[model samples]
Target: MATADPYGPVHTEGNAVPPLDPDLAGALDDLAGIHPGIDLIRDGIRHLALDRHTPDTTQTLLATLAGSSGADAITAIGHLIARLANADHNPALRGLPLDTQKQAQRHGEQAAFHLNDPTLHQPASEASAAITGT
Candidate 1:
């Protein structure tokens, strides 16, 4: 007979959550190692998710991530940087007021600059390559 215990039902191996994508996980690890203020960035992500006050830099990066269609983390990040660098030239913002568009473009350029710092890019690229098996 099965015994009833005070604890809740036990989960078997079959019921466990699937493992994370290895490449994505590795890329995140690499980013953490290279980024100077990873903890702050994480906090910023959280704040943005929770609708709290987040810096424009954080918002721009997060928005890029949200809209990116790259096959891997590295490509996605690179694409985001590129997009931010050309923010003012994007056709999608044509409907917005010129001043508002300019402000957003400035924020995007600043975000790209910070993310493209050599200190972070080198390690992140190496990590991305490892994930892509290149």
Candidate 2:
């Protein structure tokens, strides 16, 4: 079976990372279309100011998730949390400065409120009660 590259290219030619598989790139592009925060993740990576070349880190994240084992909804929620909530800690965005991390988190938190649905996320009080089984 042809497994996807769990991680993208091992080496790059002077910051020129290899092109992603067309299908994978397409899928990532589709995600960007629907999820505005996905691009925020992309922009956050670009803003990292690293000397080395960076590939599409958001796409890299999704591609990596493609190889992991998990329920679809769980994986997706986790992906959002990583990209939006814990942007700095995620593999692609790890080691970023504190301000940047906070910025990403703020955007994420705002997204949660703006996109909130009772069915999707319970109120904070209810969540706390559920967790403590109170």
Candidate 3:
């Protein structure tokens, strides 16, 4: 069973508040598996990356997507971050520290956090065994 936050819906702390319409939530969630050819993850809290989003913002986005279907919310969230990290102009996402980048590369379904930056990155799940010491 998934645990819901007492906050229920309206978000404020991280990024600007997200739209709370159930229909919008459902649509965004459906995008999870569509393979957004362009990655959506980024390091900052605005512009075209996921990093531009706050943890609460990300959570809100994921929760909305999770409500849509059988998709795994975690992975959906990860994909969004991956999209952002791979973006071309996100300063916060420029070359990352080797160790930190490695861990982000390891998240099979979840996001990897930059300990120093607190920004989320897409896990390098499939590219390298170096991440797993394999």
Candidate 4:
């Protein structure tokens, strides 16, 4: 039988953090490595590609994740990184398809480059065009 989630819901401003999908997590881990700090870089990816948050969310989100949970929470972070990276920038191009895999890899590399200092609070938009190529 399926068990209930042990850590319960992860919330940021009442928004529940997305569940970790294994495929997404694997892709992210492949791109960003399995280091714990990889979790912090996720916010950068979100800001750069998805434009979901201010570039400064890294530390805040890291604190949120640190308090909310553990392995599962980190996994969720990795999943989000991969999901944003792998996202198709142009849905209309779905028929023909862009090299989204490459784009995702580019995003992952960009984020991982910042792994050394994820809390630096730099603007994440610098390489948005290069990473997403949109």
Candidate 2, residues 26-107, lDDT tens digits: the string is 6556667556777875444434323233334433333333322242233455556546566555655457887887777777
Tell me the spans in candidate 4 whose CA falls farther than 4 Å from its real position. Answer: 1-64, 67-74, 87-97, 109-134
Top lDDT model: 1
Output the number of the TM-score-best candidate. 1
Q: In order, how many clashes per candidate?
A: 0, 0, 15, 0
On the 0 to 100 scale, the lDDT of residue 84 in model 3 is: 55
Worst 10 residues of 3 by lDDT: 112-121
lDDT of 1 by residue, 70-110 (tens): 33343455556557445356777778887877777777767
Q: Write the per-residue lDDT of candidate 4 for residues 13-90, one digit (tens) a residue.
A: 566445446775565557565565665565444443333454346434543443223222444554455455653543
Which segments of model 3 are wrong by more than 4 Å? Answer: 1-64, 70-76, 85-91, 112-134
Cα shift from native, residue 134, model 3 (Å): 46
Best-to-worst lDDT order: 1, 2, 4, 3
TM-score between candidate 2 and the true structure: 0.27
Q: Model 1 segments beyond 4 Å from truth?
A: 1-18, 21-88, 125-134
User: Cα RMSDs of all predictions?
Assistant: 14.1, 16.9, 17.3, 17.6
Worst window of 10 by summed lDDT in candidate 1:
63-72
